[model samples]
Target chain A: MNSSGVRSVARIVARDDGRGGTALPVLESDGPLALRRTRGSGAEARVMLVGAMSGPLGGDHFTVRARVEEGARLSVGSAAATIALPGQAKGEARYDVRLDVADHAELHWTPEQLISAKGSDLHVTTRVDLAPASRLLLREEQVLGRAGEEPGRLTSRLTVRVAERVVLDQELACGPGAPGGWDGPAVLAGHRTVGQLVVVRPEFGADPVTARVLGEGASVVPLAGPAALVTAVAPDALRLRRLLDEALTSLL
Target chain B: MSRAALLVLADGRFPAGGHAHSGGAEAAVKAGRISGAASLADFCRGRLHTAGLVAAGLAAAAALGTDPVALDRAADARTPSPALRLAARKLGRQLLRAARATWPSAELDALGREFPKGAHQPVVLGLAARAAGLGPVDAAYCAAYENVSGPATATVRLLSLDPFDATAVLARLAPEVDRVVDRAVEAARQAVDGGVDALPAASAPLLEIGAEAHAAWPVRLFAS
Candidate 1:
């Protein structure tokens, strides 16, 4: 038997509806969930993940789907980093996030970091489908382990499709024995936390508004255009968090 | 050592692993964005304008006997993506190895020892051209051709495009390639005539993003 707990929350902010911006109550669902919204105004709404329980204290799986209809402008962000505590049995968390932007619609999905405690495993997949004239700014941040703790073994995949065409496909697998793995100079560069941000705006010109967030111990690179990809890494989780926040602020 | 010798050095099949790299073409092809010969031609043309043009200009400057170390640094600054930089060095090392074997000039040998991690491909290609007794224009043209064709050919292989069609694409792009090379050669000549400090900086952002994304993939067919 599959005894699982599920929580679903959706919020929509319509700019011209003229309520000075009203917030929706957080909705909860005990099973698989979906949220869809259509708005006429250029408003933004964020969903915070708080008090959601899963399988064991550590091992778990969750599916999340969100869509923004045509002519709607939506922005989504998480309250804080979602933690996957070390599992008794190797555990995994899967997120299949899909965003659909219609003609001239704009969507920005910038979620908080994903922190995997030592010995935990996780996989997160995000698929963005954009129309011909649609625009999207999507960002994801992942930190392997807590400071002073062994970095968790994890695999993360991000696949982006535009106009029904696959544009960006990325997969990262990091552990102790993998060849040229996380510790290699090519990736992570021995850093514990890494963040990636992608912006796709076909309407924008070659040189869009993209900036790098550089801190004492971390670095952020921003790419601009019809599509842009950024990767940043820091020594620890805290520094990674700070760098990501700064990057999003500048990028958005 | 003549212009023909420089052309030989710039040949796509110089055994420098250039054949194995599509210079981001493989990634673009796998993404299904680049489908046919026409699109491939368009992609190559864009690459020529961006990555190819920049590398060619830099190589031309290096051919003027500019400081290899400074040229290497400038190339690195122009290439913001670690993956692309690493790819350039890998190709550079292979090219350097070939150059050492074919033409063991003291300068080329010295560069190998000095830049063990690999100097940028254009910088090394320029040095090799000079050591081979090729002029600045020849060196610049060779650099442009190699950078453009490396990816064009890679796309052909990755997408299984017809070789005849692919060559036809290359033939169509020949004029544009020549135009870019001519511009690069002129700039290189001006730099040499004036001073090596006139070399332009590298600045192509979209390619850099693709390089970084390609680097992070768990499994990839191309080296970079």
Candidate 2:
């Protein structure tokens, strides 16, 4: 890894102790990234991720691989927001995430916002593989550029599979003049920040209150095979986060 | 292969139920991203390279005799929004009815039987093209052209901006559209051996997001 670049890798796997106690996460990390484990009083364990540096910049690649074993549960979060800064060479920053949930396991990953500064480009690729009976709740939020500045390019590709079958495959490319490009009505309709929430569970029942909370310009679409997707856009990250949290809370 | 079959499939009036949706152009127009012919052309270009390319590739692959069920699942993966999925299936069912009547075949009938509600529109288009004895490239061209043409024609009604200008917008995009079809066909060839994973999955979130938003509009003119 370059001095200015941060190449971090961490994997958290939960294992049942064969007793009534909750399974703990096996944590590992390198570089400027820190992984902190929090004891779960209820039915799941918690893990907090923190970075010594600001965030991944140009030419920086950050990766996280996480899994939840059978009969185990875990929740992952970030210490603070991730700020992507412009690098010296103008290259794009990359975040690659891989997650797997075994049978009868659950994993909820709610990370902080990822803000891309001006002249910065960010690409995130997330692949999730789950067992037929596993459950997952994933939330990702992105804010393009700072206030009063031209937004940077951010492309996100997500693929979700259950029992080796593709459940959802999504690719989002946003920049100048892109569809849902900046200020476009059909896409974001001029919203600077966009957030997404995905939930897949066995008994994920219906909730009419969720749609009412999304209000204008936000939508909650229930996918086939016990999955629900929500996307919202707002003028700022705070507003978008609030809307996303509201919808997610209702679903939860 | 009857060459005229390509034209028949490519005609905008095939009654495939495409006229009801603006291809997300209505939201863009309402947001002021599509004010005139120039902006509309730009939007079409972006869509052509992204969603259009992906749709064309799927259509081409289906035309090459790829598994329709597998392609349908791949289409589901590529499409994240439920509203878009519903629209694609509706159009697929509608296209199946038309294709079965126009060019009766066992394959089309089986597909209809398999997916009574519907499959993705591109997959059905590919199967229809195959039933008509057309090649993957022809199917790709049809899907690619529809990607931009649907929105262009819809904008003509939304903005009432000169119909000539909208047609001209498509005319200028003809070269780019051909390029997209070429890429789609090439990807389809790879998909023949590499499986559905080889097909393009490039997506436009705004389209997915727009599809969802548009679906909620109780007062919208388009079905999607």
Candidate 3:
């Protein structure tokens, strides 16, 4: 057990090959970060992140960066949910994902839920930079603990910028050291799972979305920019995903 | 740095449009999550730390002389609910009007011109505190206290809860508010040196969700 922890960077750069196909110019992986170019169709490129090792244990720093050049369509996903575990190190684990979509490009960042195990502390930051004409569909889900267990400290920050202007920036902290009432009736309301879906389409710039509540635990609303944000919380991941997927259908 | 100025800015009767908003309490009330004074305290405590802390950060940053425009954007970032965003800006606009009349400052005038429709309320509150010759902590204290106090006042009208009990809920949460303010001021100071990224973004999911549901309601006591 290397209590020292690991630092990893897995990256993907997708571009239009100028031959009616998308090309991954760069696919790099280091340490526990593994990247694979799955089968793609037409002008789209897909990447699957395979965790070669179990971690982002405490004191580990992991980064995933994806850039979609103009005219390219990129879809990124993970094989399984990431489980944050406590290590001998003294600090929290860090996982950062940076995404950039150029004009007329598209990106789908549909990562699996991050399960925060007991005694584990992890901070996940996802920053997305998009062009006005760029299309993006990102789904983020957090499952507090495995099941029938209490969650450790987990903080997740999502910041998205469209056309160089911030569209949405928010952070949700749960578990230890978090402010009170997180699990109260007004926040999670005792829900152990929370998730959000961010949809940004060029058409939304002119034809905006009217805010509406989808369910008791979910709502769809517009952001400051040409984007729609859907937030939901449920008793479990299955229900959370079901709500998010329903919202996705309407959004798409 | 006159102590009374903090009172004036944080006053619920300041005509800044805060009274109309329940800080998501209306939705919580309808949800039956808050039935009495004890539940009311629980609700306010949640808000005081999440939204309250974020507001205090923005207010403290603004009072520290950070750009109001940037702070406004930060506020937009921190607020995910569109209804909540609109409410904050509306309150900000009203607060700006009141602050300009109370204490005129070139910074406030510039901010007014920048966000003619209004900025975020906490940003405006911070700038208003600065105009009143107060510091970042004072602004943070005002924002943090107001976050919980507004809902406390609103609950009295919504549930017909004993006015004494409502006041006591706020009184009991004073220490928590102070703790939130300390963290907020610390974040504000960090923001001054490290940028808005350093500001605390602690958020209550239910509050944001409840605000959205509340906005859709046709008949409601609070505007937000």
Candidate 4:
């Protein structure tokens, strides 16, 4: 990656604080990625990502890694959307995220939208691995382009595993150069905003979630394992978020 | 190896229970997106490259004799829709049943017993091709063709589309299906040596979303 672009990494490690609270003993940020510990309630640690600079530009590489050990709880979010912009170098940008949750641990990952601006190309991969008996609530949302603008190219993949078994894995390619009909009625259907909510609980294995359509373009379906995935596509980001939130309200 | 067996396996009327599923066309029709042949072509092209490509890769890999258990996990990884997964397994169970009766391979018998509820349809399709003395390309061809044919044929019923026009839609997609099969076969070859992770994870979100909506319909012409 003769990246005339930036290469950054952000990391967090949460552990049991031993006084009935969660502790983040390691918080690291580099280059364009910044992390800060936020105030939280009992047993859960909170962290917010603050973009330090612009241009997760084409030709850049960035990674975010988070780990929660047994008995620890962590919730991570972003201050605002992360916009991918074109860079001087003519290369696609790469964003990789790795998350691990141990047995009896919990994590809520609700990052803000990722926008792919015109002339930009970004490939993003996110993998979340959970131990048996782990609990997780992950919300992932992507907005193809800013309002009133044609998107460049964006490909995103999310893979989740429970107890080393794949629970949900999917990839979405949108914007220009993806493939014919990607924006057509069979895929995005002219919708620029898409999102998914994955909730994994131990009890769900025995009780199980009832599969149903949540709204106009949304549905919650139970996975083969102890998890339920809610997916939605909307005209814009706000509607996408609303649909996912509504599903979440009834789910959790 | 056996082109005749490949045709037999790829036949749309193979008693695999696929006639009941629209492969998302029923939902697209209900949504007014697939009112005619042109729109159906658009829907099928999208499905062929994304979900179609991924399924072809899995099918080819399984035909190459990849471990079925691991490939099943890989299929689960590629499919996020629970409704689609359920439908694939149901179709797989039906396909395996037909394969055992037709080819009678010991391998097919073992796979059937292993996944009694069903495996993913693509995985079962590949195993069936292998049982019939077919190769990876044949398996990939069957998988890719089925992906488009299911939706194409279903539209003929849902929209009362002209059967000739519907068949022409598929005829036009034959070139793209060839390209997709090449890509799928290449990926499967790589996956055979590297890992199941090497398989294509192309996804069609609306297909997943549509499958869910179709499953919930009180009265529908297709099962998915």
For each candidate, the alpha-carbon lDDT, in order, equals 0.63, 0.81, 0.90, 0.90
Pairs that collide in candidate 3 are A186-B206, A187-B206
> Lowest summed-lDDT stretch of 10 residues in model 3 chain A?
A1-10
Model 1 ranges with Cα > 4 A deviation: A1-246, A249-252, B1-3, B193-197
Positional deviation of residue B176's Cα in model 2 after best superposition, in angstroms: 3.6
Candidate 4, residues A99-145, lDDT tens digits: the string is 99999999999989999899899999999999988999999898888
Residue range with the least summed lDDT across 10 consecutive positions in model 1 chain A: A177-186
TM-score of chain A of each: 0.73, 0.89, 0.97, 0.97
Report the C-alpha lDDT of model 1 over B117-217, residue by residue, as the tens digit. 89999988888888788767777788777766777677777888888888887788787778777777776667666643345432233345456566666
Encode model 3's per-residue lDDT on B1-224: one tens digit a residue.
Answer: 79998888877788777888888889999988888998888898888888999999999999999988888888888887989999999999999999999999999999998999989999999999999999999999999988888888999999999999999999998889889889988988888879887898887878888888998888989997
Cα distance off (Å), candidate 2, residue A95: 1.8
Q: Give per-residue CA lDDT, model 3, range A1-252, as digits (tens).
A: 666578888889999999988999999988888998999777889999888889889999999999999999999989999999988987899999999999989999998999999999999999999998999999999999999989989999999999888888888988877778788776887899999999999888888788888778998988878999999999999999999999888876
DockQ (CA atoms), all models: 0.03, 0.44, 0.75, 0.73
Report the error of model 3 at residue B71, Å. Answer: 1.3
TM-scores of the models, in the given order? Answer: 0.49, 0.89, 0.96, 0.97
Ranking by lDDT: 4, 3, 2, 1
lDDT of prediction 2: 0.81
If both were scored by TM-score, which would come out higher, candidate 3 or candidate 4?
A: 4
In model 4, the clashing pairs are none
Q: What is the interface RMSD of each candidate, in Å?
A: 14.3, 3.5, 1.1, 1.3
